[model samples]
Structures are given as C-alpha cells and as structure tokens.
Target: MSDNLAINGGPKAITLKQEEALRWPILTEEDEQAVLSVMRRNETSLSEEPMKLEKEFAEYLGADYALAEINGTAALYAALFVLGIGPGDEVISPSYTYWASAMPAATLGAKVIFCEVYPDSLDLDVEDFKKKITPKTKAVIPVHLWGVPCEMDEIINIARNNNIAVIEDACHAHGAEYKGRKTGTLGDFGIFSFQASKNLPGGEGGMLITNNRDHLYKATTLGHYRRAAGLPEEYSKYQHTCLGFKHRMSPLHAAITRVQLKTLDEKNSIRKNNIEKLLKAIEELPGFHIYWPPPHINRVYYENDVVYRGEETGIPIERLIETLKAEGAIVRRDRYPLLHQQPYFIERGSNPEDLPVTREINEHVMALPTFPGDDGRLVEQYIGAFIKAARTF
Candidate 1:
C-alpha cells in the first residue's frame, strides 16, 4: 500500500511542527548546527559520526552500551530477537502505544500480548501484567507512556519472578526517572525513539541500550553487524549469529540526535513547566482532565499533537477534535486502539478484549502539544477554545 497517509506526510493541514521564537516548534539552533557540522565534514555511518553519538548517548543514559538503529521499531525488533523470542513465545506490552512498539515482536513470530494501563495514571497496570504472564512469556516491553515512568519497581519485580526478560519502551521518555533509576536502565534492556516528535528528536533514529555484555553482542550482531573484535574467529564461521536486519542509523540522524541529547535536560525542564501551566489552566474547567503527574512522578510532556481530554464530555471526541482543528489547534483522538483490536492482529487471531484498561484508555485519551519551542499562549488559546466548545456543544 502507499505510505501516503496525510498523517505520515502529504499536505498536512497543520504541518507536524509549529514555528515560534524564530525556531521550528521542536528544534533549536544547536540542533541544526550539529547536523550541518557533520555534513560539512562528510563524516557518515555508524563507524564514524554515529559511533560518537552512540557513545555520548550511552554515557548520558549511564548505560553500559548503546547501539544506534534506523528507528525505534527496528531497535525493538533487534532487542527482542536477541532475547530468543519467536513463534511460540509471548511478549507483553501496553495496548496504548503506537503499533510500531508491538509490531516488531509480532513480525518475529512472537505473540504480542496487550496489557492494560493503570486507570488513573495511565501507566502500565502491574497487577494485570502479573496475571497475564505464562510459561510462554519470554519478555515484557513496558512503555513509559508520554514521559510518565510506569511503576518500574513493581513491574521489574514481577518480570524477575517470572524469569521473563524486560525491555522498556522508553520512546516517550528521555530524561524520565523512577525511584532514582533512569527508565532505560531499570530493565534488562531498553530502547528509545528519537523520531521527530520524541523528547530527543532526531528526525528518525533510535537507541538500544543494556548493561549486559551478552545482550550487547547479540543486539549488535542482529542489527547488521559483521564480525568484530570481541568474538572469537569461530563465531564468524556461521552465516549470521541470529536473524538480522539492516537497522543501523545514518550518521546524519545520529549527529543531530547527539546535539539534541546534550540539550535534553534543559528542554525537558521547559516541557515540565509547560505541562504544569497547561494542567493548571484546564484542571477546573468542566469536561476536561490533564491526567496530571502523580506525587512520585516528576516528568510529564505534550505532543504538539493536541488531544482533547474530554472524550466523555457527551461531545464525541471526533467532533470536538474537528472543532479544535477548525480553530487551528492540532487536536485529535488518542489513536492507541487495543492491539488486539487491529485488523492485522485479529486476522492473525489476537483478541480486542484481551486488555480491558488499555482499550478503555485508548478510546478516551488524547494528547496535546508540549514541544518546548511552541508558544505558551497557544496552549491557552486551545484550552479556552476547548472550554467554549465543551459548553456550546
């Protein structure tokens, strides 16, 4: 089929990005300079500029090693394949995420099990996750949705007891921490998305991280690696260590991502501040809720992609989204339908009701803009417009 969906790239009514303060809503001068600098010198590929970025990213995340991949989807598939998940194996992940998160596992012949989110926090539902684990379960891919770290301590404990490997989908979370440990480091392995919309925007790139040497070796090997220094000559005698894919990130994307990583802390701080202002502005108004961060939670973010928190406002979310869009607010419904509900998964026999909480949130939730470079006044404008729409309709 054509990858021509307007959402992907077609004359998008409201471009994916907004411009303010003389900068694209999500990028900075440093981001541009870094990318151009790499191009000017003609350095490219994982062996050159991408390698430097990978090293810096690893150091910043305090992980033992980090490998850059073509995108988050590839990062996830590489991580799961190295863990030996396939055919009969099952991998659990929240249903409330982009399909890219689970499709990787599914493509590998592993059953992608959908888990429900904790109702109020919208983080992973730990209790439900425990009940779903079985002997066939090989891994758990917990997503720190929208920058909110799930209950990692509890989830990790469950994973440990079940002997199932954990690979966090930290795509939405960059600087997010849980109980002092960073999200990516909390699991046996983790992956982050550096897509244009992520906190660490790099256009299209991802990082797979781990402290385990064995996992590092396996991940790199399956991620299109030829023989390297660490392995003995005997290892290369085989065609390939395991199933592999061409998943390496280009040096250009990595160069830009490296610059974004350097400023991640500074940018994230502004995101948190912006979320708070948005929360305070819309909290008391009827037909709206911000799903504010919990006391123990410190990070929250926006998508620059607007979502109306009032799907149940008696105004169908679709209608409200249209009203907001008409006013220039890039609002839309939360697209995380239960993985089991998708035609692709169902045709393969997955069930839509498999994850109750996830399906519920998927039907009700929506995201709103939070990119740091956007004008704060726009958030207010949308909030006010939403309030008017809520009452008028």
Candidate 2:
C-alpha cells in the first residue's frame, strides 16, 4: 500500500473523465418533451396534467388512489390530518432518518416518539417500536431509508394488534418492493418525495398513495378541495364544502413526473447493478462491510450507505471520508442528526436517550452517490478510491 496520502500531494484515485456529478433528475429528451408539451398548450396549471400524472402514478404503483402535494412534508401532514392524528396523539418513527418523518407529527401537536433503527436495514427496530407504543400512539411512520424496505410484515402485525395506523415514509424507496408487494401500498398510507435529489425527480413534489377508499376520500378533501369526494347535492358545482389546505401539485411538476415515472424501473436497474458491482469489489476488504437486503426486498438505490468498522480498521470514519474525497470520490457525512437529539426536538422536551443504536449507526455511516447510469469507468474509479482509502485507514 502507498504510504503517502492523496491529501499530501499523492496521486488521486478517481482519474476517469466523467461528464456530470452523480445526482438526481437524470433527465433526457423525453423528460424535456413531456414538460414542453404541457407548457406549449398554456395549460401549466388547473389542467389535466396533474390529474393525468396522478392516474399514471397510481397505476404505476398498482395503488387504488394517488394524490399530489407541494412536497413530501405536505403529504405527511395531509396523511396525519386525514387519519385524525393530532394533539395528544403519539407518532412513532425511527431516529436514523431525515427529520421530515417526525416533523409532521411535531407540527400536528402530536408527541413524536423516536425509536431505534436496525443498523443493517436502517429501518425501525420492531422491538424498540413495540416498547414505544401506548394508548396515545395513533400512528407509526416506518421510514424506508436509502431505498431499503423496512420489515413491513412485523411492523404491520404490531400496528394491527395495537390498532395503530401504519404509514410508510417511502421518500427514498420509489420502485422498491417488500415480500413481492410494492412498499407504499403495504401501509394505510404512504408518502413519497420527488424532490430534486430523489430517484424519480420531479424537482419538488410529493405523492400520497393508499388502498383505502375512505382514506382516499378524506385525503382528497383534506388538502385537495378540487378533488374532494362526495360533495353534497345541495352544494353548487366547484363549491368547496370542507376545510382543507392548499397543498395541490402544479401541472408542470406533474407533467415532468409522469415522464420520470416511466423511466424509473430502468433507472433503478442501472443503479442496482452499479452498486452491486461496486460492493462486490470492496465489501470483503477488512473493516469494510455492506448490508445486503433480504430476498423479499427489491430495493431501488437512491443513496449508497457504506459502513466502516472503525474498531477493526483502527481508523476514524472522518479520516476515511477525507481520504476518499482527496482521492476524488464524492462523499460526505450523514446530514441529519439522530432525531431524538435534534435541537428542534430537544427544545420540545424530547428524550435523547430514546435511540442508542441510531447514535452509533450515524457515527460510522458514510453517504455515497448512487445516481442512475453512473459511468462504469467512474464507478471503477470510485471502487479504487474506496479500496485505497480503506487500506490507509
């Protein structure tokens, strides 16, 4: 192994010529045409584009109903409101995820109970979740972190026994499946984000999907008055009968999303193959390990998480990340803090000790890029950079 580090003027690992940095909204001419078609018609809003996107999105997921929101946060809020989760209620969610999962609960005046996550799956630990449930527990949001599906069967069973609503926070798991079923459909309601960084990028938008007609009706009326269900006969046409928020999706976003949805499967396949090849190359190296999903999961790779067994390598994770970046691999630390310890939660009297595993996982986990159609040569360069950096660690 080379004694000199790249930071000290040694040769960098990534030497390939790649066109663009790895990220989302991997658009093509089709994506352009899709949005242009909507724009050219001057039907940018209050048009069929958003509704058409909803229909196509629902069909794509094999879901009974789908509705759009301005963003994932709005979708979550809408889900909670439609399900009657509010003040005095408690919502459980894993701590090792984006704060969006818990923010809705907090904003609803519901107590947010942050739970531990299984390190391998990065999902809520069933045992920990069970311990958090109380009569006040009205809902559980199991986040499918990094496109990995949670143990849905166990979670569903627990929620059913406790009579708690299960909402899958599938913002990162589009095109993913669990136990031969799509992830978003397994729960009472599922929320997905098509943020600029997501697998199926729609710039900034969200989708809520469910199988329950009642949920659909409530959800439609809750924030989407235009799509409200069961209007009274006495009500005039286009009259809003129910109270709702302005969380509707714009036609421009929906039009772009429709085209992006069509290419999701193919994009996911590319990401999966790229990740598999990269993992195979370096997973066996000392102190380097990758979590393999269970057979029942067909996960899409929105982000790549590499766990460094620092005790085994005798190197700090920060040092490793610095070395990888010096070697030309675009890498970074986890962006979100453990939910229980976040200032936003702590100021509201949250208990930091509620999630021990989450704290440990966040310490060693490193984020890697997993955008679709990543250059094969660049991927090889990344593997080389990772392996070389790991050796130094």
Candidate 3:
C-alpha cells in the first residue's frame, strides 16, 4: 500500500506542464510597447507617466487623489507620516500579515501594537483590534490579507468612534470589493503595491489614495517633492525643499502598470473562476478547509492557501507536503512569519505566545499556485493529488 503513493515510487498524479499556467504578471506586447515608449521618450528619471498612472488609478477606485511611489513600503511610510504617526503614537496591525503592513509605523518612531487575525478568514480580528487600541492609538492598518477584504464596515466604524485613522493596506487586494465598494476607497487612506508578484504588477511600484485633501498634500510632500509645486498655496512653497524622500515611481513602471490596470478586472475574474473551480473539487476532502468569503465581499487571489487539519487527519504537515511534492504538485507551507514573533518585535517586548490563532494558521496552512491563466487540466490533477494524499494518510 505504501508503494501506491507517489512518494514511494508510484506514478505522479500531476503530469501537465504548469509553467505557463502559473506564470505571473502576464506581460504582453502592449506592456512591452508601453515600457519602450517611456524609454524612447527618455523619461526614466521623471515624467508625466506617473501622474497619468495616478490619475487613472484614482479614477479606477473612485478616489479623489492618488500618489504613485517607488514601492509599497514607501507608500505605507508616507501614509503613516501624513497621519502624524510619530513618537508616543501607537499603530495597530495584524500579526499574521506582511511586515510592511505594520513595520512602517515603527520606522516613524511610533509603537506598533500587533493584533490577532481571524483564523478562518486570515483578516484582522476586529475584536482583537478594538482591545488593542488606546489613547495613543493614532492609526489602525487593516490589511486585506491575500486579497480578502477585512471586516471593513465594522473596522471603519470602530476607528471612527475612537477617532483613529484607518489605513487600508490594499496591496494584495487590487480590484477586490467589500460590500460593492472597492478596497482602496473604504478607508481614511488606502495603499497598494505594484510589485512584480501583485495582481496588478508594475515590477516595483506603489500608490497611496485618499479623499482628504490635506492627507493627499502631506503624502505628496513626503515623497514627491516635484509634485508639491502644484499643491495648494500652503504647500506649494515647499516644492524646492520638500520632506527629502524621493519615492516617485519610474515612468517605465508606470507605463507597465497602466497597461496592466486596463485588464485587472478581467484577469481577476479568470483567477476567481479558476480558484472557485478548485475549491469546488476539493471542498469535501477530509481534514482540508478553504475560507470562502461571504456573498458581499468579492475577493481576489494573490496566493492560494488551503488549511490542513494535521491533528485531525493524524498526518504531519511536513509529510503531507512531501507527499504532494512527489505527486508533482507545487506545494509549500505558509509564507508569512508572524510579525510578533520576529526579533525586532521580540526586542520591543512583543510576546509571540499571545497570538495562538496566528501561530496555528502559520503552522497548518499550505500554499498552492494561483494559476493565472486557464489550466483546468492542471487544476484537476492537483485536486486528484490532494485527494490521493488525504486518502493515503
């Protein structure tokens, strides 16, 4: 019986080629031409492209203003800076998300209070967030982990009542909607990353969006000094000696991003359909679970992660991963390390043991390729591999 499993020399279940199916960014001739146009125009250092991209992005999200930055981290830092998050201030963020979501506050001399995430949705647990806030809480960053929108309505209401600013980290959630409203438009400030791996890739870029004019001007002054000249009279004087950080997105990146943005919804739909198909196939598998969002939230897929109940199946996660790999399925453990457990936070007195749910999720969740292109055959094979591994264990 052991020999029947792929890890023991049996035939691999997944035999289809997956390179094209899982390829990201999905660059085409249009993207290439856009980049070449920037190069031919010799606008690598500065150009109107970034401004154009910002306008288009803001329009796409129905936002009042948008500022393009060098990268997502810079955009986040600018967001914190504009909010006046400085010494003695406290910023609340989820422990299970990417470091940029919370670490930027620390850079601004503010204390980062790491909160817990819901084990089911992998989003900020509003109850945990509410408990973490205090008089010093100047801002709360609700990260839409892996493109799943957080409980925005509740989070926004709680923040409003307490007068805490909401910075929506919508880096992984481009084109995702919560209650029919886009992710970036739902907060006091919204931030997005256009890194190569993002749903809307720009190689390496980010954008900050907001409806507040002051916030927009301040964020622009933080990184985009050149654009400060166009700001209202109160800020235009600082154009020459702006806040000293140059976080402008490259014209080439903006060019690529603009083309990518044009097809974001269509591409997102493809990914959504593909992932749903896989979920449907594996829903009944023992000891496996996928978090399907409520009807009102339209989530996109940045990475496909399925929770494995190792204790229930009596199968070690390591063993399950090994078996799946042998069956030709590209599988791995969860990527993000709990921010509270990292050395920087540890030195700052963050206790890892406090976030049991995040630790459990980090331990049991396994990632699979979010096939960006149509690959029904490969997905079917992956489903078979999952089923076979579960039955074997």
Candidate 4:
C-alpha cells in the first residue's frame, strides 16, 4: 500500500474534496452598501471614497500620508518618479520578485541590479545588497516576498548610510510587521497591491504611503489630480501643475477596499491560525520544513510554502509535487526564474553568475494553500494526503 506513489501510476492518496473559495475580497452586504452609497451620491469618479480610503489606510498604518493609484505598479512608478530616480541611476532589488517591482525603475532608464535572496526566507540578501550598492545607487527596493517582511532595520541603515532612498515592494505583504512596525511604513516609500490575489483585494488598485509630506505631495499630484488641487493656497482649480499621470483609484475600487480594511486584521488572524494548524500537522514528517520568520516579525502568508530535502528523502522535488497534487492537495513547485538569467534581462545585457543557493532552493520549494476561513477538516485532509504521499515516495 505504501508503494502507491501517485507519480508512479499507482492509486492516489485521498479523493479530491474542494471547498468553497473564500480567500480574497470576501465581500459582505457591507461592502456592497459602501459601493452603492458612493453611486447614489452621484460621486462616481472623483469622490470621497478614494480620499477616505487614503485617510483610513494612513491611520491604519500610522503613516503621515497615503495616495491611492490604479495598481501597485503605478504606485511604485510614482514613487520612483517623485524621488527623481531615472537615467543612469542604479536600483538594487531581489531577483525572486515579480517583474513589476524592478521593471518600473528600468522603464525610467535606471539600471536595475538584481541581488540574491536568502534561501529560506526568500527575502533580500543583506550581504549581496551591500555589495551591489555603488556611487550611482539612487534607491533600493526590497520586496516582502510571500508576505514575509524583509530585514528592514539593516536595509534602512544601509540605505541611509549610502544616502539612497528605500522603496519597499510590499505588494505581497499588507499586514506584515517587522520589529513591531508595519512593512510599508518601514522604508522611505512603501507600495501595496489590491489586485484580486493580494491580501487586500479590490479587484485592481494600490496605495503609496510615506512619512514625508514633500514626497507625499509629489506622489499625490502625479496620480491624484483633483485632490492635490484642493490643498490650501496651492493653486486655483482646473490649473494643472507638475507633469502627472492618470493613476487615480476609482471610487468603486476604493469603496470595496475600505470595507476590506475593516476586516483585514480579522482575516489575517484566520490565515495565521490556519497556517499554524497546517504546520503542526506536518511537523513530524521527514525532509519537510517550513520557513519561520523571526520572533519579532509577524507575517501574513499569501502562499504557504514548504521546502523538501530531496537528498534526504531520496526523491526528486518535482516527483513529490506531482504526488501531492494527485492526493488532491493544491500544491505546486514554487519556481520563480532568476530575473538576471531570463531572456529579457539577457537581451538587455545582464550577467548571470553564481547564485547557487537561490537556484537550489527555488528548485526544491513547493507552496500549499492557506487562505482565510480554512477549517479543521480541510487541514486534516491536506496533512493526511501530504503524509501519505511523502511516506510512499
């Protein structure tokens, strides 16, 4: 019976049992009413919704100012533009993050230096980050990958000593905290995503947050035209100043996001609980390990990831992933091709060198689902399937 490794054409582990999708944008009647109230007031486009969202988010994060944008990428771009990072400057970022994180800097004609990430946490490698800093280093964008906060204290100190701006690519980490402070507020600028898959789901939206009033003002004007015009004694209405773009967040998206904010803490708590339960269930399994953040750090897992020691288990990582999938577990190899090694970067003349640990970890990692509202039964089933598959393999 134990020889029934699913990848070997043997009988599967558990019969598939899929539950309802209750992950992102878990809307209630309250969410609907918020949107309806905006429309009913005939304040559809340039309404109070986005303003209120910015205010609420600012208050939530204890930030001095916040500006809503069309998406996280736009928020990041606005930050880069406002900080004057363009043309011949270099911005160091992790190679394991989404393209949007570093692409905006490159799009602005800045050289993007990809750095290696810590194998276990998948966060920025502090040693590599220091080595990448040069005279032309204008900014450093550290991503909180998979909702795990980066080493903010070290990164902040490094950026300050080098006189470089720190822009946190916190799209994946909404409620994550490092050393008792939220992720977005840790750096000079922090950007969040409200895409459907993000922790804060508004279909598509984003917010840029900062403690500096001047930086906020510049970012606000770039994306928020009407609101910026209303500031006291700045300028008359309908007078456009400062080359800006149409990156405003629509009222509808803002309304949904406001409602989402009300329950984000509660939702994150549930996700944390579910992840804890799942971890405990799989703790005794051999060659299986989950990355745990520092004691002072509080993380919200966007995707629960686990690493397997294939050498110890005498099994290939890919084979283990297939077996897990056959057992009705929503598991997949967590592979993000090293950015410097990609064809796009190769075409742009990026030299790919030794990042042995990063490449090895990426090849051996797999992610499991740990959305909010997970029940005990589901956790038990997932663990049972995982154990069955692992032992068989």
Which lDDT tens digits does candidate 3 get at residues 142-241?
9999999999999999999999999999999999999999998999999999999999999999999999999999988877788899999788888998
lDDT string for model 4 (219-327, tens) is 7667666667765444224237535578889899899999898888888888888778878777678788777888988998887888788887887777777778876
| Reference-based TM-score of each model | 0.86, 0.94, 0.98, 0.93
Better of 1 and 4 by TM-score: 4
Candidate 3 or 1, higher TM-score = 3
Q: How are the candidates ranked when ordered by lDDT, highest leading?
A: 3, 4, 2, 1
Lowest lDDT sum, 10 consecutive residues, model 1, at 1-10
Model 2, span 1-393: residue lDDT tens = 454669788888887655564646678788789888888998887778777878988888889988888889989988898788888999998878888899988998999988888877788899999999999999999999999999999999999999999999999999899998888889999899989888888988999998887776676676767666445433223237545577888888888888888888998888888888888887877776788987998888888887877798888778878888888777888646777888888998888876667887787787887746675667888888877776665
What ranges in model 1 sit over 4 Å off? 1-18, 21-25, 226-243, 302-314, 390-393
Model 3 stretches with alpha carbons more than 4 Å out: 1-3
* Model 3 per-residue lDDT at 237: 83
> Which consecutive 10 residues in model 4 have the weakest lDDT in total?
230-239
Model 4: per-residue Cα lDDT at residue 246 = 85
Better of 2 and 4 by TM-score: 2
Residue 166 lDDT, candidate 1, scale 0-100: 89
What does candidate 1's lDDT look like per residue over 221-300, in tens digits?
67654533345543343335433567778888887888778778988887766656766766666556556656666664
Which segments of candidate 4 are over 4 A away from where they belong? Answer: 1-16, 21-23, 231-242
| Best candidate (score: lDDT) | 3
Alpha-carbon RMSD to native, per candidate: 6.6, 2.1, 1.5, 2.3
lDDT score, candidate 1: 0.73
